[model samples]
Target: MRKFRKDNLVVEIYENRIEMGNSAAEDIADKIKELLAQKDEVRMIFAAAPSQDDMTSNLVKISGIDWNRVIAFHMDEYIGLPRDAEQRFGNYLKKRIFELLPFKEIHYIDNGESDPERICTDYLKKLNEASIDIICMGIGENGHIAFNDPPVADFNDSKLVKIVKLDDVCRQQQVNDGCFKSIEEVPKEAITLTIPVFKRAHNLFCVVPGITKAKAVKRTLEGKISTECPATIIREHHSAKLFLDQDSASLLK
Candidate 1:
């Protein structure tokens, strides 16, 4: 367990799942309160993954959170999947967060039987109009951030959102998470927000849990800034923090 401080942001790691979740929720609630006190609206981006389950659930339970003044955005979605599909990222967010809150609006990538390019363009426009107050995300076992797999990650990518091919590791991860029945059932492609968009957030809270993520977490935290480990870029962001339970941080020296 360690804390990393960059400018006004503080990232604290915990050795316990319950402690990590509780601390992250409290931090998020504090940030929301601070934002609401100074602005009429607050925009946030959320990652939909099993690792975020506890954090999102606790966040929704926070009292005095002005959900009516909040606009929520999701990180990425598999291409060619229906929004209502069991494997859809949209369904995950709806079941875990949006349905549990009174958010003013929730924007998600429209990967539901639409033209891929058109969906990307629409989401790019929506992100441009939003002033993201916080972005909550998790690191993949492959060290990928969002769908920006190691092979395709670009720190200076001009496109806010793009279609990306899922690497083998990433596809297998979805299967392991039970989002799909098997590796072959996972989509090969997805539309994801680029690194620049993630870095554009006023604050970033990265939650990583489980032994499966230990290697990736260690590399990302103690690695050189490069596309090979996309999450390493978080270390460069002035307002980014990483939260990890003991299992995820186990490999860190």
Candidate 2:
């Protein structure tokens, strides 16, 4: 692994996406063991995206994780999409990770609810009721974290979860990732856990791969810590670690 640091953030780069994923999966699996030893249960948050594919796949293969002692949750979900839309973040995760492992429970944001505000509050309560031990996430092509794109990210956001309009760059990225055939097909809005929620997690394992993410990776490691490039906030979290493939880390100094 090629390794480096940006302020408090630790960055690891591997030759290929698979290797990067394996390394992250090993570390997280070990961390889960450490946490479960002291607590009856653990809470984890996940980001659902193509970037997380390799990591989640390898994570499920690791032996000895007491998945029964874990409660799983995802960070964001599109609003106003058809109830059966295959592009929904929850369904993406269900196919990639949730169904691959057996966790005690899985909580997904109900994006189709008639009252988005009320559901956000209900999810916020669930987040506050437990201390999140792990956050498995990724940086977007536009440098967003979850759906907290530049325009909506707040370092001191008052609410744990909120509904917000998706910025153009963010919506277009879905098309680039093949989640949607066109930008018009992507949901214009989403419900997401705010920056403060990510900061509160005891450990943050960020998996960002592909050439498409090179610019965002560079800004995340070299830019000023600000919401303009929301992923830059990772530099402020001492517990956060970034995993990248050579393609993504290529532009970083």
Per-residue lDDT tens digits for candidate 2, residues 110-149, read 8345899988988888888889999999999889999999
User: Which has the greatest TM-score?
Assistant: 2
Q: What residue pairs clash in candidate 2, if any at all?
A: none
Off by over 4 Å in 2: none
TM-score per model over all chains = 0.95, 0.98
What RMSD does model 2 have? Answer: 1.0
* Candidate 1, pairs of clashing residues: none
lDDT, model 2, position 99: 91
Give the whole-model CA lDDT for all candidates, comma-separated.
0.87, 0.91
Local error of candidate 1 at residue 33 (angstroms):
0.7
